[model samples]
Target: MNESISDLTVRKHRGMWGWILISLLIAVIVLAVIGEIVVHRAMPILKGRVIETLSTRFNSRVEMEGFSVSVRKGLEVAGDGLRLYPQDEVVAAGATDPLITLGHFSFHASLSGLFVKPMHVGTVHVAGMAIHIPPREMRQQTPKGQRHLGKIKILVDEIVFDDSKLILGTIKPGKEPKDFELSRIVMRNVGPDAPWRYDATLVNAIPKGDIHAAGTFGPWNNESPGDSTVTGRYTFDHADLNTIKGIGGMLSSVGEFSGQLNRIVVDGTTETPDFSLDTANHPVPLHTKFHAIVDGTSGDTYLQPVEAQLGGSEFTCSGAVVNVKGKGHIIDLDVNVPAGRIQDFLQVAVKTTPVVMTGRLRMKTKLHIRPGPESVSKKIGLKGGFTLEQIHFTNPEVEDKVDMLSLRAQGDPKAAKPGAEDVHSEMVGEFVMDAGRLRFSKLNYSLPGADVMLAGEYTLDGERFEFEGKVRTKAKVSQMVASRWKSILLKPVDPFFKKDGAGAVIPVKVSGTKSAPKFGLDLHH
Candidate 1:
């Protein structure tokens, strides 16, 4: 009887625990169904809250047609015919265009809100959008620390624009705005603590051209996008320069820059290598290396040190280039070359040298280029001088004549070949350019057999030259010429203008095309 009682009590305890477990399971199921109903009802309210918050925070008019909530996507929102405008702008009369237009937009919430630590926006996809940013001065302003967007305490991790157009007003007054269109651009890591990275191909809307860039931006604030820093590299290959206003011709350039934009002023250092400048006369572009401190505020780029290689010569140049809006451009540069070959002149200059020349050239040049057309180069103003020293002549006839004269004092005929006479002169000249012509003054050529002094004018574009001068010949050069019956031809004229100098002085006139010059020696100038 005692054993039967113990077994019945154990069975009763097991039956009681099983009933309790069943009751707990039923309660859990009921709660889950109720929770689902509540969430379904709350979604509509959640959508309104999002719309109100965004509209109030951005200080813009906002609306949405579709909204929902999901465990995976968090709060999902989509809409068409979306437009965002500043509050005052909508109230203002005659507003031409809204600041931004959104044909279709989508937004999803970040799941990290459960952790509630760092603020992150999952993503914002803006499709078929257009943004028109007006000129800096004309743009509407909200007092600092007072803008609704600035007051918001949320961070956005990413924003994307799909098939969007961006219109940016010029910093310069009276200049037209610039237009760029992009397809599905992605901008990520856009919080204050993180750097924003982006990649996109942008097309010029009006004058069609394309440029591609991939870069990082930092210190970005949502309210004031212009007040940010950028570190990036850009390349435009075989692009039309006219696509950007105020710049013309064809450009194929690559450059890198690191700068911050404060309002409309951009301050930074920039460098471009193998930049080609093409224009009307020059079908083949001229390549240059540009390194400078760029200042957008002052409308000037100051190049402390710049370099270029044209022909076989290397030039060190420094200057300031300024754009004067309606007046075009102003360029002031100082150019210097330490060592240059004279025969190399034909490689760069418009003229073909008359003689084979080898020399070391030193010059101090100040050149100013004004705004104009293709003739701008010819019309540039230049004030400078050059010294040609250690010059060698490869012409055999000229060398032999000058050598024989040099040997006159030594009375050496065996040295007639004039191997040592291959070179013997130092030529110097100072020039001033006005209009399209250069006037040469204080020009002197000191040679072994003769010294020639000249003054002349040369038309740069026409490649024409005219000069009047006197050549004073020494013992051998004068005696060699006087021995000819040609002396009889000048006997009547020699006495009228004859001069007692180092030897005989002859009046000469130089007139010809630079490519094929002519020297006339006669009593008449």
Candidate 2:
């Protein structure tokens, strides 16, 4: 009877302890569920703090539409219409514009960041961001210790940006700045310990081309920020050339770039399907393909081995453009055209010459062009030689003069069109020219009535043609300037009409343009 009573007491005691443990476990579960609701209620207070914190960092005004937290309301920032203003101190030359605009920026992290550790952001998404940099001339120079984008450091893991654009202006005063944008900007492994890789789409490139590029960049070492390098390749297909500014009407280009993003080395190829001397109207159709190797940074660009083709003409050139920083462009080029029609290529290449040329020709030339508020002839120089085969002359006034010569030399004057006339010759010359003048060192003129050695300097692009030269005729004066019916007119002009031993030499003064040449005696001689 005593053992039975002892057993019942022990069983009752164990049963009571089990019930106590179950009640405590139920209480803990209820509190945890209630905590979730309490945390959600506190979001308003937390959101205010986040806005204030960010506003201080960029020295700008910041705002967002709303905030929603996921980790029991512990840590995360979500919602849209997040914007920042970096233009507070700017006094606009025109209407005020935001320096940077962000449409939506969001990120999330583990709730443990509140107590145990800093937030380890897993992903960040930015969308509809537009960046417009101020022109250097508009802003006062930055102080010595201030931070600039090229030297700044950013800490992030993986970032994705959609519908983003960036505009960069030339920092040097007075130079035209470039405007460009990138859509679908994506970068991965961007932290200090990781190699950063990116892919993007370029909008509104030169010649109104759209480009796409893929590249690998830095785990930028903060120790030496300037040393980071970037490498990439790009393709621009079937661009509308009419939309490009300054350099007009061309198409199709591809390129590769390597080195620092701020200063890079590049090479590319371009093709134009319809090339023209005047881009705005009456465009001529000619195909041109060009390959180039370009180097240097903002103020200078060196172009070596610029090879091209247009119609039946081919050109190879090497050049450099300097002083792009402020003083305007100074250009140097060494070029060779092994074979071509002079009429087809010369007018288009210069873009400013108004003369027409005719012949099959070969040429080699060197040019130095420096333009300024000062004198043009003093700074510009051109030295070259040319060979012309089956040469024909065309200007209406010249054609009339040539017809008169034909009549005097016992041939028909009005036989055919100027280009189809049966008279032809081979000519060679060496010359020097500049923006203001062209000087022929040696020229040979051969026809049925006249074979002459000529040398002169003509005012280039001037309204009036002014030239003086020594013309030594290889034929007699009467034969050169007279016919059987015109001997009476020649005897008074030249005393050596009948004496043809060494021919006649005259100092000729020629004035007026190709259309209205007025020849007179050289009174100065």
Candidate 3:
């Protein structure tokens, strides 16, 4: 009877212990289920915070299609299809698209940051991001004393974007906004109040080059974006100027820029080893160092001054490249050359192999090129005056004729029969150019003993040359003949040709082609 009691007591104790173990296991499973439910519920709260943060920071409405957080991977957060509307109510009302959009983004953060005021995040990887800046008239201003997002702040260690773009809106109706492709963008220390350090790689539209830049981008001024500061250094590489219709070159540049987005001051140097006009088809080394202000909105560049060297010719120009409504870009420049080589200009402007004339040249001109499908030479318009000193024609026959004319004008007609030799001449002219035709209004040409005042037109193709003028000489017409009999014969006409305090004055006309120019007396004139 005693052994039975002991066994029964032992069995009761075992059953009681088994019940306690089962209850404890069930309690643990229920607690885990509650914890998961709480986490799932907190996700919505976190997403709401993110949306609110973005909205307050940009002062715009924000929308997101999907958002998710995973604590399994050390607090990873991700979202998709995010868009931020323009702050301007009027613009937002008429806009079919948002000001900023993101296809997808992901970042990692510390769990403790959720309880902090300013959450710190690791690199935020973004894809398919685009920022569209509205036109100035449509831009919205933050209200006074409302620029900051009161207390909540989110500071990013780095934000990286791959294959993004920026579109600049225009005020012109029916015109498309300018789009710039950004292959890669990285911003460090991105926050609402401080300027972000950025490194960006983009493709240039006009000359089709690749540009890499490092800069500080913005503490954005939402009210006036043009007032926001930006500073950067850039390198433009492998720019093919042939992308432009009428010019050709392989260009490279390095520069630094500072100022706002709309009005940036850029100081840069460009090098083109094979710069050439398509019409001329002769390559020349071209280089320039320039100071310019670029209007980002209008796509215009204003040159304070540009110092350029093409081959051996040096010139300085200041002007604006402006975009016309119906036309493309109009390049209007004021060009000045204190001294340069005429051969250098001809080598780049004319198609001829051996240049026609060589001289020391001084020029000042207003150069205009209208945008068109025409070649650069055909579209170039110039109104200018130039002085050519120590000018000499390249052709032997032309040089001989000039020498002969000089000798006869000095009353040494016998010596005028000498063979071809170098004879220097000087010319000063005011010219206007249209359609490759150069018209000279006031042309003063001088050799050893003769001076000529002329008006003429010279075709760029060397096709036609026509000039009519008066030639004045130090000698009388009677002394202008090599033969004694001819001199006596011309003595009667000497008084008729003498005028204007000159020994002899005669009307002259030059005509024919460049290769075979004809010089004759213009008796009618």
Candidate 4:
């Protein structure tokens, strides 16, 4: 009876202990469920903080569509459809779209850091971010000493963007805004009050090139985004100038820039090994170093000065490349060459293999080129004057004829044999180029014993030359013949040819192709 009683007592004690343990397990499960509910309810507070931070930074209103938080691995926060609008006045005026829009964004942070006044976060990954900056006049400046009642400040270690876009709004009534497509962007130490270090890659719309840049961009100026500061260095490679229709080249450049967002000062150098005009199709090496001011909003460039080299010739140019409403970019430049070679200019402008003339040259001209599909020679316009000294025709036959003419004009008919001597000429002209031809209004040519004044046109293709001129020589008509009998017979007509205080004055014409030029007397004129 005693053994049975002991066994029943032990069974009762064991059953009681098992029930207590089960009750404790159920309580713990209920507590965990309650805690989860509280966390879900408190997520709105975190969302509000994010909105408040952005609103205070931009002095605008912020809105979000969805928000979620995950503590499974070190506090991950994510959201979609975030937008920021302009201040009260702009909102009241009924703007169509928000100033900034983000499709989706996410970031990681320590759970303890999320509850702090100034939150510190890890790298933020953003996708499909678009910034639409309004015209300067449409925005309002923030008050000088305004303080936020409950501002939530956030400091980010870095921010990364896989795809983003920037649009600059214009003040012109019907003009479209400028757009820049950014492929990738990374910013470090991003905060509201300090500049952020950034590296970016983007496409250049006009020339169709790749640009990689590293820089520092502002603590933004919400009132006038153009007034925000920016500084950077960039490398632009494989820019195809053929995109402009009339020109062709593969250009490369490296540069540095600094200033406000709208107007930036840049110093750079460019090199193009095979730069060529479509009309000529003869490539020449071109290089330049320039100092310019660029208007980011309008895509205009104002060149203070550009030092350029084409083959062996050097010149300086200053001008503006501006965008027109209906047309594309127009180039207007003032060009000056203190000293150059005529052959170098011809090599790039003319289609002939060997240039017709060689000389030391000086020139000043105004150059204007409008964008078009026509040949560059047909589209380019130039108004200028040039001086050539010690000029010589490149063809041996032509040079020999010029040398014979000089010898005969100096009253030495026996010495007028070709291949016996060489002669150089001087020329000065005021010219205008249009439709692939050069028109000279005033042209003067001089040699050792003769002077000529002429006016005419020359085609750029070297296909035609038509010039009429009056040539005066030191020798009389009787002295120009080698035979004694011919000289005596011509004496009677010497007085008829004498004019302008010269022994002989003749009306002459130069007409023919470059290879076989003809010089003859034009008595009909």
Candidate 5:
């Protein structure tokens, strides 16, 4: 009877322990369900707080959806679409309001002590985003005026924006709208305090081929507004030059360029940015540096008084002022090409025709372009002067006795153009050839030629050209002169006024356009 009572008591104790274990498990599950319900109920509030905090920090309107929070871990805020607007009054015309639209964005925030403080975001990832900047018309309507008006500036900490589209438009009155589109762009940021570095490899970029760029942004400290600077290095590989020309409205012959820049220092308070470029193996291997001041209030003018050293040559050029408008910009530029070795350039222009020439030439030109106001009618006028000394032209086909000659000529820039119709549009100059003889310099052709001295003054106006000169021949060369004229004109050769076949002096006149230049002789012995 005692053994039976002990076994029954032991079994009852085991059954009671098992019942307690089952009740404990049920209680734990009930507590978990209650905790989950509480979290679910507070999610909207948590999301609202997040939106409020971000909006206040960035001074922009922010929106998000689908928020989840964990007690010990962190908050996972996910949204099908997110948007941040520049201002509250911005209205989207004919479509949904143009806000920075992110297809899907998520933020993981580190939990703070019992929700007493806002959670710290560990990482924010934005995928399949589209950022649409409002047109200039909408911006201009803002009360802040033109300077601070337009587009929402974005700041993100450690973001990954992928497969995005960005559109920038300039709306002007009475003119077609101008817009720029960036498609399929991917960007990655490192850290908040770290430089806003980006590694973007773009394919089918607007005007040309694929481009890959990796660089770091310089220090950007908002406390000291004037102390901001940006330094980067970019390389363009096999890009189309024509596309570049279309964008900048400047002619470039280069196909590829790679270079490094020290820094781009901009002082927003002072409205000036100093930039430098060190490039090589380009169309015109350039090592250029310049500083420009941006207009603080108007933002219309950019002034650059630059000095550059290119191709071992010193050049001073400046866009004294550049005015930026809706469609394009206007530039007032002055350029000076110093006197340098002209042999290489001459060789290229003339080819290898076996002619030796030596001299130095200097040029100064001005170019002005107002691209927007008028496109095709843009006027380009060139004015410059050049001097050629010790100029010579020789060929083996000519007389062998005198194979070398020297002369000089100077001309005005205005008259250099072909078919310019102005009496004053004449390139006035004088030339003298010595140390060699021309077979027909004195209109003579007797066997071997004549010892002739030639000097002339010429003028060219449009298609009309005129030359007046005198050629004097000694007695030993007078007969040669008469015979040459006879052969040339098929007439009896005789000196108009000759005494015993003595030396004769003849006055010569050459006139007419370059197309049909004519020559005449006035004999006076």
Candidate 6:
């Protein structure tokens, strides 16, 4: 009886152990199935949710392929590829119509935060990104009450673009549509949060050149609208200057350039943003700094009241606003050219000519123009002084090889106009030389045809000039003057000549404006 009871207890214990083992196996299988479902099905839905959230934030279409999620330890979401498109519609500031119509675009992201809320991005890579800005159509329909719509900002960790095209349109008068295309491009952001902290390189881009840029963006705050700053260095290698001559050519004289933007600040609440371009080793080497304030609330086109100092040359200009016609706003400007050497003046005047001189000159002028029009001034008022210590003409034909003359003059520097207000002006000045000599290799004064030696001090004013001092002539000079006068004019034109008909210097005076300055010789024996 005792043996039978013990056997029964043993059997019961064995049965309990078997049941426990079987339950453990069943739990394992269920958990495996659930894991498979989460990886194959639930993960993709979560990815779609992520894409939806980002699309809402950026106001653009987003998509991903081969998306997968991990849930063993932490939440990890990734995809083979992803993309994003430009917002369906974008309107530039101050424009009532949409300017950009984009196509579908995409990108990829590695997401984290399976256990935590507000998922974090471990690594986000964007690929096959292509954006299109459709050409402006005359009859296209746009959303009502929309001042402007477009991609104001784009954030991505890595982006790759292939065979991209862009079209720009001008509704204003006298402008043609423009387009740009690119073959391949690759861009990457180093930091995750500061996505604009980026390095991008483009090859076979429009304007025919390769471009490379790196910079950072954001930390936006309303208190300081310019708090969002971007600093980057870029190089445009082997670009065609003539292609963009209509725009950038006005400021620089280079076809190829590499430089850096040390700092660019855009204030959200301000009307103007401040920026600087550092151009080094370019053909022109332009270093310009600018400041502007823009109104954030109102989408009024902000014009940068540009005040720049270029290579010791300062310019103060305002009212560069853009008009409704898509043209630059006209502004009244004042420019002061400080006293500098004639060499510097020549550099600013004619770049190709090597005609060199040593002198100082100052000129003040006013400029008037409407935005988008060529710089044109209705009237230029100039009052300045120039002294040519030694004016030398390099042309060998002239007899005066070296001119040790000093000149001072001031006048309005505007060309004369017909049937308009008097655009002409006068200047009063003098040219003086002490103990100077001129050797004219060939000098033929039409009236006398004499090889003459001239030396004196002269005072000049509107249409009049006077020379007081001695003028000497060579021995043959007298005979030649007589012969030339007889040949040219049967009757002697001047009564100052004596019966001997000798060549001699008398009191001389010249008076005239630049257009009709006259020369007079007073021969008092």
Best by lDDT: 3
**C-alpha lDDT score of every prediction, in listed order:** 0.59, 0.58, 0.83, 0.82, 0.41, 0.36
Candidate no. 3 TM-score: 0.85
Ranking by TM-score: 4, 3, 1, 2, 5, 6
Q: Write the per-residue lDDT of candidate 6 for residues 372-490, one digit (tens) a residue.
A: 33312112122222233223323222212111000000111121122212111112222221111111222211111122222332211112223333223222212323244453562
Best-matching candidate per TM-score: 4
- State in Å the error of residue 11, model 3: 26
Segments in model 3 whose C-alpha atoms lie over 4 Å from true places: 1-43, 68-76, 89-97, 110-117, 140-142, 148-153, 170-179, 418-421, 512-516, 522-524
- The per-residue C-alpha lDDT of model 6 at residue 312 equals 39
- Of 1 and 4, the candidate ranking higher by lDDT: 4
Compare candidates 3 and 5 on lDDT and give the better one: 3
| lDDT at 185, model 1 | 72
The C-alpha stretches of model 1 lying farther than 4 A from their native spots are 1-157, 160-185, 200-211, 221-226, 236-255, 262-288, 326-328, 342-345, 351-358, 372-381, 392-421, 432-438, 459-463, 472-505
Best-to-worst lDDT order:
3, 4, 1, 2, 5, 6
**Candidate 6 stretches greater than 4 Å from native:** 1-44, 55-122, 127-196, 201-211, 219-229, 233-240, 244-335, 341-358, 366-390, 396-525
Q: What lDDT tens digits, residue by residue, belong to model 5 across residues 1-525?
A: 999999999999999999999999999999789768756865665666656654553345676544556543445556666676655444433223534677787766544422545444545677766645445445443444212222221234556666665443334332332222333333345333456665554454424655454556434332211123433333334444334331221111112211111112221111011111111011333334444543322223343555554444455666644435544555666766675433332332222233233444354656465554332212333333334433322332221222210000011222323332212111112222111111122222111112223333222111443445543344322233224554355223335523344344456665554234455564431
Distance (Å) between predicted and true CA of 103, model 2?
A: 9.3
RMSD of each: 9.7, 11.2, 6.0, 4.8, 13.3, 15.7
lDDT value, candidate 6, whole model: 0.36
Candidate 5 segments whose C-alpha is farther than 4 A from its true place: 1-39, 58-74, 89-99, 111-114, 128-157, 163-169, 173-284, 292-310, 320-333, 341-359, 367-525
lDDT of 4 at 129: 92
Give candidate 2 regions above 4 Å deviation.
Answer: 1-104, 108-123, 127-158, 162-184, 188-195, 203-209, 219-221, 237-247, 279-297, 326-330, 346-355, 366-385, 394-470, 481-502, 506-525
- Candidate 3, pairs of clashing residues: none
- The positional error of residue 316 in candidate 1, measured at the CA in angstroms, is 1.9
Measured with C-alpha atoms, the lDDT of residue 157 in candidate 1 is: 65
